[model samples]
Target chain A: MKLAYAIPAAGIAALTSAYASAETITIATVNNNDMVIMQELSDRFEEEHPDIELDWVVLEENVLRQRVTNDIATEGGQFDVMTIGTYEAPMWGERGWLEPLDDLPEDYQVDDLIKPVRDGLSHDGVLQALPFYAESSMMYYRTDLFEEHGIEMPDQPTWSEVRDWAEQLHDPDNDLAGICLRGKPGWGENMAFVSTLVNTFGGRWFDEDWNPELNSEEWQTAIEFYVELLGEYGPPGASSNGFNENQALFSSGKCAMWVDATSAAGRIYNPDESSVADDLGFAPAPVAETPKGSHWLWSWALAIPATSESKEAAKTFITWATSQEYVELVGEEEGWTSVPPGTRESTYANEKYQEAAPFADFVLNAIREADPTDSTLEPNPYLGVQFVGIPEFQSIGTQVGQQIAAALTGDRSVEDALNAVQRSVERDMERAGYLD
Target chain B: MSAVQTKRPWVGVLAWVIALIIFFPILWMVLTGFKTEADAIASPSLFFTPTLESYVEVQGRADYPKHAFNSITISLASTLLALLIAIPSAYAMAFLPTKRTKATLLWMLSTKMLPPVGVLMPIYLLSRDLGLLDTRTGLTIVYTMMNLPIVVWMLYTFFKDLPRDILEAGRMDGANTFQEVTLLLLPLSMPGIASTGLLSIILSWNEAFWSLNLTASKAAPLTAYIASFSSPEGLFWAKLSAASTMAIAPILIFGWMTQKQMVRGLTFGAVK
Candidate 1:
């Protein structure tokens, strides 16, 4: 009986001691390559701080967004750290859902972050999140195909030139499409590309008074051009293809040109991953009636949620993960080509990175030039080039994207789709009280 | 006899064709799991060197055994709990004839039609308030509630088909309600109960949405494990396939092993 009592007493004491010493911080992150690398390298952070344990909850992008948003809104205290984007950081920061990231150790060099990238993650002059990597849109084309076809791509091509190039290079008999673009129906999938197309074609989602302009002449022209281009020269089942599908198609030598996030440059230029790595060329994202908002600004960043009990430990981990030292560590451990790019100006200046990534300067210039605040041709009530930074934009954008995808798949006419998009947006804005 | 044999051969051939067609997607997934990432995305072709590289990478990246254990524990527990609650309710509805019994059964099923997302916030908040978030116990509870209606409905159907005379005889033999259910109803409805349990187990195992929302690292199951492979930048098709292959392997084996029993239970009342 004494032995049994002592055994239960010992177990209770052990459990109490174990609970008293260590602080485990849970981080909810997306399953992107850079975030995965961070997870792999997190052992160093754990080893350095023995008392602070790390628990990772990696989820897919949309699921991660949903989980984090649900947790933060309810103050469930499930996550200490969250991987959010430019769209959510500002909105959430303004709502005081995120912890302000203004205070950091001096050597962290917060100013080393690119202006546009950092600015996108800030709200009202306060930093809300630290950028893991930033990106802009650019055109990736096949150099060999262009050369063989005797076509010279300009430094900055117009949409008309791109269409003509696509027409000339299209070879359906050879199972090669002229261009691969995102057609998956999501707010961030097809709409991201479509919004830029509309912006460059002198259109906006909403005018200055928050009235939706989706049925405007500019939108009609842009939607018509998009459907015609993808329908004519795109691969079969293009409506189901998103960034990943298009990336796979482009990297496999099936696509002649792919206009997508500049962050894909690393994978597109890596010979191990891309079959056409040696035959790739880079150009600015295509323009139409205007140059404004031709490219989008986006940053995937790490932020501490207000509901965290382990805020300090989470902050420490975030600082370590997004620091310049982390960049150096990734470069040393995984080659220079695999280092997270477009976050810090110092990364572009590094001789090793510049040598490994020849398109660094081009990508950096595009990121610098993308202005989220003034992304539309007309005056608009929202920020974001590819997306509007309002909370309601997700559902609205996804609805419009589905309609646009219907048009792309020949399930609906462009005019009808745009009209439906306008009607939905109007209903949504009215429901959200954004419009009377 | 010769004419019957010829017709039987054609029926067998037709069955085989249908079975292969039904199985083609799984075969394609397993095949894609063995291909390199590049080759997986390459034009559909049967020729490619099979590699264990994706399996190696997937195992190295995630703790598969942990996720498998969670899947097993949560699924088995939820199914068992659902059976415990459902068997009694189904027995009552089948044997007892209250005027509201049918309406009550329909109402229970109607709750299933409401989208899981529609009540996600309230459930999430309730779970948090009750300190049930991220616990296997919490997940088992939600999954039990989520699958309870179906389990009840299935068991009710099976129990209804049971001969009312047997239960009536149990009462006539001076047995109480409990004794009647245990001695007469349960044993007689064993096959039906087994089928309901099997279905509940399968549904709980493959459920992703609630598991993804309600649980994080501590109690996450194989569904969450498979979801981790999907990235925003691109899908690693080969790795995703390998992860999926690993996730579904145990369930597939379990299903195959019990398929005979399941088929027997399903056909128990059909002929009669």
Candidate 2:
């Protein structure tokens, strides 16, 4: 009787303790394809650790950013996990708003992360967020179209060469355009591609002492080149086509070339998702004066705010979600074509992934070659290749972007738009106390 | 009367044109919900083989019933609470006037002018302090506060339009103040009250800012559900349309079923 009572008592204590310690951690994320996959595969995480329950707040990008920024700034403790991007991770981490994630377990092999990706989310040489998916801008072309046109594509093309090729490939009568580039005006929309264009043209957003450089020769040349190229050969209403619109255009065989993020490669490579998947060809983004910052680097990373009460659980979840084993799980379950790309070397080394994604090595190289710290040909104060990496950059970049759109639309002259951009950017800098 | 008859047929055709123009976007959404992702971004066309894939996927991915429940309960509960508070206040303001009445009314309406973002931090902190963050009770309270001004203004107008003689006669018949107001004022202005309540419910149901900011997983309404279907980096038009269709179905159905009373109540004071 004593033995049986003791056994039952111990069992009850263990069960009750387990139930009592169960922590419900709320994870706030943006509604991206990779995030959706993570949410779907999180059941595996639950099975591994039954002592934690997950609550998700999947929102659109801007809403999620505002919501998380509000919560973090106020220390409201609403979300334990936040899905932030490279742009925010360093900015937030520098302010000590996020917990440093430098001490992940040995099995995680944090060194396996692509260096640029790892550095992109770090501040003060300490990791603050773990990358879930990363991308570098690249050029994708239609091999079939090139072959039919008897054009020999180069491994590394210059802007002049591209313009010449676009002249040959331009076929508006056949409903095929020469190229498609992001045109919608926003910091991350047209400005992302445009910044890379400016970088390769040896232009920088600011010089030393944070002086605005929109009046520079490089800026004028790059913007003029872009406007003329797209105006002559881009699709009708090219001003409204962002990444998705361009992808749809490319997928439907309406565009012969697209220069955009490498993340689209997976979708474009899938025969089910793209009609021209088999005929797709890719190369590094074109160069003009310099190759430094020829491509932009971006990543969507998972991080924990300092206000989280359940930091340990949030860390565990983020680590697992970005783990190599998780990559394998995604490959087996959701197919290798659907796996989150550009984060892990182990992913590239995986035979199945390599077999599934032919451009895996090329994408990995593009992501690795991107150096955010030393991106421009000239010395600059900011950290990003495509952006200035300040809170004020969003407003400034979008304003410049809108001005560029006005130039394209003939509402303003190129010189007039550049002058407006120069003045507004200087005003912004002065208000930001960056200039006297 | 002869002129009115001549204009009637032309007015009917014009009304249909206006209605269809207004309804076209929602109809487009409904049609897009049944298309494949490829078909959705192809071009706007009506003739495509309808598919249930997007609807099936959206419902399978999200907790539709729970979000619907939160939307219904929050909207109805908030409307009821607003009515409970506003009806008496409006009655007092309508039947009994004061020197600062106009100023008070203006001050109440001014709260609506300040953007919701201005108060986000304070309310978020307050919600945290009250331990009501992400709770339905918290959302209900915030939404009640959201719709109170309009509810009060609408009810005040409604009550002011009523002749004060009915309540005075009820009082003369030996009925108490509470009884006179409830028995006389509420019933006689039933259409106005019904319309105000319905409008309040619709406003609360359609509210996105407070609903998103105040609630997370547990009490997130259909706005959040619909928000989850959109992605800045991916193609999700078909899925987004499906989620939107389901999100608005409840209110749309409610409006359709009560169109008769809604039409009457909405047009109650227009002619007068």
Task: Name the top TM-score candidate.
Answer: 2
Encode model 1's per-residue lDDT on A231-271: one tens digit a residue.
99999999999998898889889999999999899998988
RMSD of each: 4.4, 6.5
Interface RMSD of each: 7.0, 10.4
| Candidate 1 residue-wise lDDT, B1-272, digit = tens | 67876878887788899999999999998999999987887779899999998899788677676677678779989999999999889888988869999999999999999999999999999999999999889999999999999999999999999989988888898999889988888898888888888889999999999999999887888898899887767547888899999899878887887898799788889996
Worst window of 10 by summed lDDT in candidate 2 chain A: A1-10
For model 1, what is the alpha-carbon lDDT of residue A433?
95
User: Which CAPRI tier for candidate 1?
Assistant: acceptable
Quote the lDDT for B12 in model 1. Answer: 74
What do the candidate models score in CA lDDT, each in turn? 0.90, 0.89
Top candidate on lDDT is 1
Tell me how far the alpha carbon of residue A32 in candidate 2 is from the true structure, in angstroms, after superposition.
2.0
Q: Is the docking of candidate 2 incorrect, acceptable, medium or high quality?
A: acceptable
- Tell me the spans in candidate 2 whose CA falls farther than 4 Å from its real position: A1-21, B1-7
